[model samples]
Target: MLLISIIKTALELLVKLLELSNEGLHRLLSDAGFTEQRAKCQQRLADWLQGVARVLTQDGRQMTGSYAEGWANSMVQVNGRTAADSDIDWTVLAPGQEFHLRGGCERKGSCKDATPLQVKEGHAQVAVGAGSQPAVTATACGVRPAQDTCHAIECCSSFFKNRIRKLLPYNFDKVHLVRATRPSSTNELRVSFSFQEKDIMRNLSTDQGQLFTLIKFIFKRHLPLTLDTPGLKTYHAKTLLFFMLEKNDTHPSIEAWQPHNLIALLKESLDMMLSFIDSSSSPNECMPHFFMPDAPLYFKNAGIGGDFDNTKARVRDRLCELRSDISGVVEQLRGLVRPLQSEKFYFHPFTLLPLTAPPAVTEIRKGMYSPEMYYKFADVYSVVHQCVSELQSESSDRDTLMRQLSILQQLQWCKCATLCMTAMAHLKFGESEEAERLAMELQRHHVVSGLKPQDIQADKYDEPAKLPEDSDWAWRFCLPCDSPPRFPFLPEFTQTLFTARLSQPLSSHLYVNFRCLSWSLQAELLRNRAPAYAFDHWIKELLGDPDLEELLTLAHYSDCRWHVRLSLQQMEMIEKERRVAMETQDEENIGWVRQKWWRVSNRSGSGSDSGAHRSSEDEEEDEERRLWARARLGLVAMETAAEQRDSWTHTKVSWMRLQ
Candidate 1:
C-alpha cells in the first residue's frame, strides 16, 4: 500500500513538471516574437503574392506552406539567434481554372465532413466566410487539367518563360522551386495541397498549436532538422501531428493532448515516427500524406533513394535515443525559457541585425557603411507604414498611436524608422516638442558593424541563383538584385543600390537616406520658429557628406548628390510651375500642373515603377526616363545625346506644356 501510494505521488509530480515545462516553452516562444513575427511574415507573403498576381494578371495565385498555415517557425536559430527561414510557397494556377475532371474527387475519411478547401475535380468548392484573415479566403480552382487537354508542366514553363522571366532582377527574384514531380511520362508537374492542409491546420486548438511550434522549435534548436532533411522533413513531422490529432478525435471529450502530457506527447510522436521506419518493408512503403493516405510523404524522391534510407536509419536511431531520455530532453527544452527580462534589445530575424546598441549617427556619416539589411528593412517598412496609415486614418484615440508605437518599439532594429514615424505622428498631432524629441532620437538610432561586409557583387542581368541550401542563412547577399517594384504603397528611398558586378561594398546609401530624412524633419519643425539661416548648419553638413558624391556616381542616382537634393529640386520646380500658372491667373492650369508634377516627382523620388514587373533592359529605360524627368523638373538641359533621346522626355514635356 505504501509502494502504491509513492508510485501515484511520483506520477503526479512528473505530470506537474511536464506542465511547468510546457508553460516555460510557451513563454520562450512568446519572448522570441513567434506570434507577432509569424503574422507579419504571413502578411508579407500574402502582400507579395497579391502584388505578384496583380503584375502577372493571374489574380488566382494563393500563398501556402507554413506561412498560410499560421504556424510559421520564424524563431529558427542560426548562430544562436533567430532568423527567418520562411520560403514562400504559392500555387500558380493554369488557364481554365474552374473546370471538371472525368470523375468526382474523393477526400480522406477524416476530411469527409470538412469543407473542401480547394477545388479538385467534378465537385465545385467555393470559399466560405471564416473568422480570421488570409487562410480561410479561398478561390475556385475546379480541377487539375486533363493531361490530354493541357500539359501542366509545359504551361508552367511557358508561363515562366514568357511572363515571369521577363520580370527578372526585380519581382520574383527570390523564388525557389522546392519540388517538381514527374507523376507520369505525360504529366510531369508541380503540385501543392496547401489548401487542403490549411483546412486541417486551422482546427488545431491553442495547446495543440503551441505543441506544433514547440516541436518545430525543438527540431531547429536541438536536433537541427530542417525541411531539407531527407526522409525526415519538417513536413513529415507536421503530417505526423495531424495524424495523431485525427486519431484522437474518436474520443473528443477525453483530451488526448494536454499541457501536462508534453513530454509524453513528444515521446509518443517520436515512437510513431520510429514505427513508420520500422514497419516499412520496402522503398514503396512510406509515411502516408495527411490529405492522401496512399501517397507517400516520406521518401518521395526516387533519385535520393539511398540518401533517404540512410537518413531514415539515422533518424530512427535518434528517435529511440530521444525517447529513452525524453525527460532529460524536456528539461533541456525548459531551460530555453529564460527569466522575463525587459526588452532592451530585440534581434530582428528578418534583417539578421541586432537592436541592442545606441545610435552612432557619426559612425554612419564617417564610415559611410552601406546597410546589408537596407532593402529588406525597406520592404518591411512599407508594410508597417501601410498599417500605421490605416490605423492613423481610422482611429481617433491617442491609445491607437501609442499601441502602434509600442509595437514598433518592440522591433528594436528599426530604431530610425520607428523614431521617424513617431516624429511624423507627433507632428501630425501638433506636438512640436514630441516631434523634435523623436527627430533627435532618429539622429541617434542604433547601429552595429565590424562583421565582414556583405559581398556587393551581383549581376542584375544574370539569371537569379538557385535558392540557398538549408544550412545557408546568409541568402540576402547570395542574390542581391534590384528591389521589387511595390512602390508608392509606402515611401521608400529614390536612390537604387549599385548591385551589379560590384568590386566591393559601397558607402552607406541607407544611412545617408535616413540622415536626409532626419534633417528634413528637423527643418520642417524649425520652419516656423527658427531663423531661415538656422538650416545652414544642416545644409553644410549634408553638402560635405562623403556619401553624397558616391550617390551621383551610381547609375540610378543620376545627377543628384542625395535624396534631399532631389526633393529640394522637385519642390523648387513645383513652386516655379505654380508661380508661372498664377501669373497667367489660370486656376485650372495651376491645379492641373501642380497635381501632375507632384505625382511625377513622387514617382521619381520613390525610384520604383507602379508595381509592374520589368526586365533589366526595361529597368534601364525607366532609369534613363527618371534622369530626364529630374533634369526637366530642375530646368536643366540634357547632358548627353542618350538622355536627349529618352522616349518619355517628349511625352512628359508635351504634357507639362499642355497643362
Candidate 2:
C-alpha cells in the first residue's frame, strides 16, 4: 500500500509537469509571430532576388517551410522554426528553365588539367547561349578582390538586362545547393523529393500528426546524450511516421489515439529503427529513403555496425521518459506478443492511390492535418453572417449595432473590420457620431498597425497553403489567383490564400494583398466569407499577361461576387451629400463625411485627412517622413545584401579548389 501511494504521487507530479510544460510551450508558440516574420523575410529575399536579373523571373520560388506548412512548433531549433535557429528553404527555378543532363564530377581526389570544382561549395550550372549549346560549368565561383562582389553583381546585371531576378534566403547568408554524386556512379544524379514528403505529411490524420509531433518533442528533448547528434537527421523520425502508419494496426474506435496509446506509438516507432540498422554492413549506413526506396539516405560520417549498436544501447537506456509518458507500463508482457522489427521494406502504401488523378484533382484531397480549422472557420462565419443580417436592417438599434461591432472586433478579422467600418462610413440614412468615431478608430488600428505592402508577402500566397484555382500554370507554372478552388472546404483559393479563421491565428496584425481585395467588395466578403476575390488583376499585372477584366464582369451574377454597379451608385450618393454639405458649410455634416473619406482614402497608409481641421503643412511633413523612411530602408537593404555577398564569397574561397 505504501509503494502504491508513492507511485501514485510520482504519477500525479509527472502529469502536472507535462501539462504545465505543454501550456508554456503553447504560450511561447502563440507569441512568436513567425508567420509574419517569415513572410517579411521571403519578401525581402524576393526583392533582393529581383536585383539578380533573370533569377527572379523564373517560375519556381517556393517558401516551403514550417511557417508556410502551418505546422510551426514552439521552438525553431526543434521544428525548423525561424525564431532561434532558422533556415529558409526557397525552391529556386534554375535560370535555364530546362534540366540539362550533365556529366558527374570526377572523384579522383584532385583534378589535373580540368578545373576541380569542390562539391561542398555550391556548383550552380548556368546555360551559355541556348539549350542546345554546352552549358558553362560556373564552379570555383569567386571574385579575387572583396570589392569585386559588387562587380560580380554588376556583371550579372549587365549580362541579363531583361531577365527576371531570383531572391536569396535572408536567414541564410548564402545560397547552397548540392548535386549529390555517389562514390562510383557517373551518369546518375540523386534528387530527393522533399516536397512530395511534405504533401504526404499534410495528409496525415490528426491523431497521427499529434503522435508524430509528441515523438518529435521527445526526440529533441530526452534522447540520451550519446545518441543525440546532428548526424541523426530528422528524416529518420519523419520516415518512421509513414512506415508505422503503413503497417501498424489501428483500432476501429478512437481509443488508439488516447494519450495512453501514445507510448505504444512511440515504442513501436523506436523499434522500427532496426530497419535503418544493417547487420553485416559498415558501422555507419544510410537510412532507407521513404520517397525513393531504391536510394538510401547516405551520410559522410555514419560509423561502423558496432558503433550503431552502442548508440542503440544508449537510446534504450534513455527510455525512462518514454516509459514515463505511458504512465501505466506493466512489469512484463502478459496478454499479447510485441512485433519484431523488419530488416527491409518491399512495399510502399503511397503507390496504391490512383495515378490518373490530375494535379488539380489531387489538390482537393487533404488529410486531417488541422481538422479544427474547418469548425473554427464555420463558427466565425456564423457570427459574421448574423452581424451582417442585423446591420442590414434599417431599424437596427444602436446597442445591437455596437454589440455586433464588438463581436467582429473580438474576431480581429480584417474582412469583418473592413466591412463594419465601411458600413459605418456609408450608412447615409442614420447613425450617431459615436458609431462613426468607433468605425474610424478600428480602421486606424488596422491601417497604422504595420500592414506591409502587397509585395512583401505576395510571394507566400502562391505556395501549397494556396494553389491556383486549377493548376492554372501561366508564366512558367505560376499559380494565378483566379485558379478555381479545388478543395471543397478551401473555397477561397481563387483570391485569398488563407481565410481569416482557417489561417494561422494571429492577434497583433494581419497582412493581406489589397490588390485582390477591393474596398467595394469588403461587405460581400463579410457576408459570404468565401475566398472568391478573383486573382486576375494581381496576376495579370505581375506576369505582364493581358488583363482578364472580362471574367470579373461575370462575377456579379454569382452570389459570391460584389455588385459593382450597386456599390458605385451608393458611392455616388455619398459624394453628392459630401458636395452639398461642403457648399452649405455644415460642419457637423462635413465632419461625418470627412471620417467616411478617411476610411476609404487613408487605406494607402498615408493617414491623410481632408476635414476642415486639416492643414497642407501636415501632409507635406508626412510625405517627407515617408520619403526619409524609404531612403533609409533602401540603404540598409543594399548594405545587408553586400555583406551577405562578401561572406558567401569568403566561404567559397576557403572551401574552393583553385584552377
Candidate 3:
C-alpha cells in the first residue's frame, strides 16, 4: 500500500511539473508573437493569392500545413537559422475538369471491388469500383497505381507550378517551391491531403494540440544537435501525433490525452517511435502515411539523408533527454522561439500600403513634401474601396467584421477612412445597432483620439508624441525603422535598399488626419444619444477650422486627388460657419443649421427650400423658409447616393467623403 501511495505521489508531482511547463510554454509562444505573425503571414498570403486566383481564374487556393494549423514556428534557430524560411503549403485547385482522370488498378488479375472500410469523423470510406478510378491518381495510392495515371498527375502538377511561376510578381524570389518526389521517380506525382490534415489538426483537443506543438518545437531545436543529415522531418512528428490520437480514441476512458497527461503522452509517443526504430526483426522500416495507411512515408531507397536507424536512434536519445527535463525543455524552447525585437513605431501608416518594395529615400522626400507618393496611396485606397464596397452588399457576422478590420489595421493598409466607410455602410443597411457599436469603438481608438483638433496642431509645434507600445498597437512584423521588411508579407527588398518609411514623421502624422474623417460619422451616431445642438459642438471641436483644414490642404497638395480637394473645399465651408458662429453667438445654432443645409444641398443639388417658381419678389423673399423643405429632400438623396455607392457595382461618390 505504501509503495502504491509513493508512486501516486510521484505521479502527482510529475503532473504538477508538466502543468508548470505547459504554462511556461504557452507564455513563451504568446510572447514570441508566433500566433500573430502566423496570422499576419496567412492573411497577407491569402490576399496575394486572392489576386492570383482572380488573374489565373482558378477555383481557389487553400493554405495548408503547420502555418494553417496555427502552431507553425516562424522563427527557428535550427536548419541554418534563416528568417521567414518556414515552408507555406498551398494547394491550388485548378479551374475546369481538365486534370480529372479516372483511376485503375495496376494488377491484371480479375479485379474485384474492395469493400469500404470504416473511417472516423463521420466520414465513410469510398467504395472502390472495379476498373474505375478516383479523381486524383494518388488517392488510395497504397499499392503502386497505373504508371500512366501517376505520370498524368505529375504533368498536372508541373503545369500549374510553371503557370504560377510565370505569374509570380518580381521580388517574390524568396518564395520558391521545392518539389517533393517519390523514391522511384525523380519527380513524383503530388497529391495534397492538406485539407484533410488541417481538419484533423483542428479537431485535436486544445491540450493535445499544444502538446504536439511543444514536442515539434523542441524537436526542431534539438534535431540538428542529433545529426547533420535529414533524419525525420516535422511531418513525421505530426504523423505520430495522429496515431496517438487514434489510439486514445480507442481507449477513451484512459483520458491520457488530457493536459495533465501531456508529459505521459509525449513519453508514450516517443516510446512508440523508439520501438519502431529498434524493430530489426520487422522487415518494414518506414512509417505509413496517416491518410493512406498502406503508403510508406519514409522510403529507404529515397536517398533523403543519413541512415534511418542512426537518425532515429539519435532522435530517440534526444527526446528521452527532453522527457527527463520537461522544465529545461520548456526553457530551451523559449530560446528557440525568439520574440521579434520590438521597434518603436514599427507599425505606422506607411507599413499598411503593401508596397512591392519599401519607398526609396528620394521617393520618401518627394512624398513628404511633393505629390509623387499619391499614386501608391491611391492604389491602396482603390483596393480598399473595392473591398469595403464589396463588404456592404453582403452581411458578415460581428466576428468576421472585427477580424477583417483588425487584419486591415495591422497591415497598415487601412486608415480611419476605411472603417468610417464601413460604418456608413452599416447605417445604410439599417444595421443601426451594429453601426452605433462600431462607431463608439472607433471613437475610442488612439488614432481617432490623436486627431483631436488640438492634438493635430500640437503635433507640429511639439515633438510628435511617441506611439504607446500597448497591446492594441503591437505590430506583427516589425523591424527597425531603417530596415526594409524582408518577409513576403511586404514588397521585395534589395540589400542596398534602406529607408525610413516605417518612421516617416510627416506621412504617419498626416495619415492620422486622413483617418480622422470618421469623426463625422461618429458624431452623426452620437446625435441619437444627445440633443441636436450638441452635434454642432462635437463636429466643430473635432473637425473645426485651421487644424483639420491645414492637414487637408497638405494632403491635397501632396496627393492632388480630386476627393482630397473636395474634402478641402467642404472644410473651408465649415470654417466659414465657425467664423459666423464666433461673431453671432445668439444665432450660432441657427446659422450652423443653415450652413449644414447648404453643404448637403450642394452635394445633392437640392435643398429644403421650395423649388416652385416664384411669381414675384415676395416669394423669393420667403426662400429661407423654403430652404428647410429642400434641405430634407437633399438629405434623402445623399443617403440614396451613399447606399448606391456602397455597392461595388456603382461608382458614385461616397456621401461620407463629401462630409
Candidate 4:
C-alpha cells in the first residue's frame, strides 16, 4: 500500500517535467524529425481529397467521406504509422439517390425491401453503396426505369464502376485503392468498405472498445508469427462484442452493466466467440450484424466444400486456442483491475496498461518505482495510465472527475503534461484555484498553438453512435508516446543531471501534433453524448439530467504562423479571386469564396478582476459567472496553435470550412 502511494507520487513527477515548460512534445518530435513526414502525409492526403471532391462536382456524384464524417483531425500517427493509404475511406456515391425498379423483370413493390444492386458472378467489388452513409434512406421508392434511370441490376453495377472511375483523380492508378464486396442474400451485394467498418467500430461503447483492445492485444501477443493457427484477428474479437450487445438488445450504456463485472464482461465476450467457433465448426456464414435486424449485409453458407472445410478447421483450432488461454489470460489482466472496486459507483479503466511499472518510471526513479506485484517496467505511457486508473478507482462522480481527466489526457503530449496531471490532482483533491491556474495555462497553450475543433472532431467522430445517457468510465486509448523528458538540473553537477538533458530542440510544428495523445477523454464529458459505457436502463431510471455539459473548452485553432503562410499563398489566391468577384459585384461568386481564419465565435466573459473587498454576494456572483458564462452551443474550448519555434510544417486546414 505504501509503494502504491509512492508509485502514484512518482508518476506525478513526470507530469511536472512535461508541463513545467511549453516545449515538451515539440522537443521530442524535433529530434526524431517526424513532423516533416507527417506534414507531407497530411498535405498530400488533403490535396488529393480536395481534388477528388472538385472532380465529383463535375459529375452527379459527391465525395461524402469528409462531409458525412469528420476527416482525421489533428491526426497522430505514432511510429510513422498514421499515413496508411487505408485511412481514406472514400465514399463516391450519387446524392439524393432512390432505387427505381428497372428492366422488364419481376415486379418489386418497394426499393426499401428490395435492391437491384448486384455484381457479376466473378467480380466481387462492383461498387454499390460501399458501406456508405446508408446512401439511400428507408423511403418507399419503386419508380419505373423511365423516371429513375436503371434498366437492370447489371446497369447499377456498371453505373457504380463508372461513377468510381469518374470521381477518381487522373493519377488514380498510382494510388492504391482496395475495393471489396460482401454478399447480401444470394443475389444482393453490399460494398465491403473499410470506412463502414470504421464507423461500426467508432460506435463501440468505451467499455466495449477497451475490452476489444485488451482481447486483441493479448491474442496477438500469443499468436504465431504468421498468424496461421486460425482466423483469429481483431475483427473477429470486434464481431464477438457486436453480437454480445445485440444478444442482450442493449445500447452501449454503461449503467446496464453490473458493477465490478470487468472480468465477467471479458469472459462473456470471449465465451461468445468460443460458442461461435464451436457452432460454426464446419465452416459457416459470418457477417456483421448477422443476428440483428436491418439485414443489409448478408452471407450465405457456401455449403460443404474443400475450401469451406479448411476454413472450418482454421476457425475451430483458433477458438480452441483462445479458450485454453482463459486461465492464464484472466490472471494477467486481473492485475489491472481497479482498487477499492467496492466503493465506486462507476470507475474508468483508463489506466488499464500499467499492470507493471513502465520503463520511463523505473528509469526516472532508478528501480524504486516498481509495483510489488510486477517484475518489469512498462513505459511513460503506462506510468501515466496507472495514475489515471488510480484516479478513476478512487472516484465515482464521473462527471466531475472526467473534467480533470480530460484536461490531463488532452494536454498529455505537450510540455504541459505535468501541469495537466497536477491540475487533475488539484481538482480531484478540491484544490480548484491551483487547478484553475494550470487549466488556464493549458488554455493559453492550446489557443496559441494550431490545435482546433476539427482535431477534437476527428477524435470524436464516432461518439454520436452511443446512447445519450451512457457513462464513459471505461475510457479510450490513443497514441502511446515514447518521448523522453528533459531532466532536472543539479546545482552541484550530479551525474544524473548531465545524462538526461535533451539533445535537440522542439520544432514549431509540435502544436499541430497535439491530437495523438496516448489517451482520449471519455465521451461522457460531451453534451448529449452518453457515457461510452453505461446501463441503458439506468439512463431511463435517472430522475434528472446527467449534467450533460462539456467540462473543457477546446477549439481547433489555425494559428498565427499557419494563418500568415496561408495569407501569403492560399489566401493570396483567394483574395485575388475575391477581388475579381468584387469587381464584378457578383453576390454568388463572393459567397462562394471563403476567407481564412474567420469563424463564428462564442466567446465567454473576460477574466475575473474582483478585489479582496468583495462581499459574499459578489463571491456568489463570481462563481455563477464561472459556471454559466462560457460556451453556449457546446463546451467553451481552448484554441491551440504554433507561432515561434525552430521550424514547423504547414498543412491544409480544409476541415475549418466545416462547422
**Model 2 misses residue 351 by how many Å?**
39
- Ordered from best to worst lDDT, the candidate numbers read 1, 3, 2, 4
Better of 1 and 4 by TM-score: 1
lDDT of 1 by residue, 1-659 (tens): 99999999999998767555755555555554344333333333333333323322223455455644556434431112222233334554444422221112233454344342232211123333211111211111000000001112111111121222222212222111112332221211223344445545544554566566666654545454432333444676677777667656512235665555555667677777678768766543346555444345444443343554455565566667777875555556555444323322221222211111212111111111122223333333333434344333634455566555655454444455556656756655667788777755644453331111111112231212111112112211111212222212111222221122112121111121333444445434543443312233343343312122122222222222243344334434433423111211122222323333434444444433322334564456556545543442333464553354343355456656765
Tell me the tens digit of each residue's lDDT in model 4 across 292-371.
22222212233324354465555456556656555444334333222221111111111112112223232222222112
1-659 per-residue lDDT for model 3 (tens digits): 99999999999998766546645555555455444333333333333323322222222445556644545534431111112324334444433322211121212233233232232221222233112121222111101011111111111211122322322212111111122434433322334444445655544555565567765755554556433333566777787777777667623246775545666777787776666556442223446665444345652334444354455555557656655666666555655665543311111322222222222211111133112323333334334433343343345455554444443453333445445545654655568777777777666653322211121121232222222223232111111122322211111111001112333321211112223334444544653554212222333333422233232322211212333344445545544433211112112222323333333345432332222232343244234323332332233366553443243122223335544
Local distance difference test, per candidate?
A: 0.39, 0.32, 0.39, 0.31
Residue-level lDDT of model 2, residues 59-105, one tens digit each, is 33443333234332323212111222222233443553222111223
RMSD of each: 23.0, 23.4, 24.2, 26.4
The candidate with the higher lDDT, 3 or 4, is 3
Instruction: State the lDDT at 330 in candidate 2.
Output: 19
Error of 3 at 527 (Å): 37
TM-score on alpha carbons, each prediction: 0.41, 0.33, 0.39, 0.30
Model 2 vs truth, CA RMSD: 23.4
Global fold similarity of model 2 (TM-score) = 0.33
For model 2, what is the C-alpha lDDT against the true structure? 0.32
Each model's total of backbone clashes: 1, 18, 15, 48
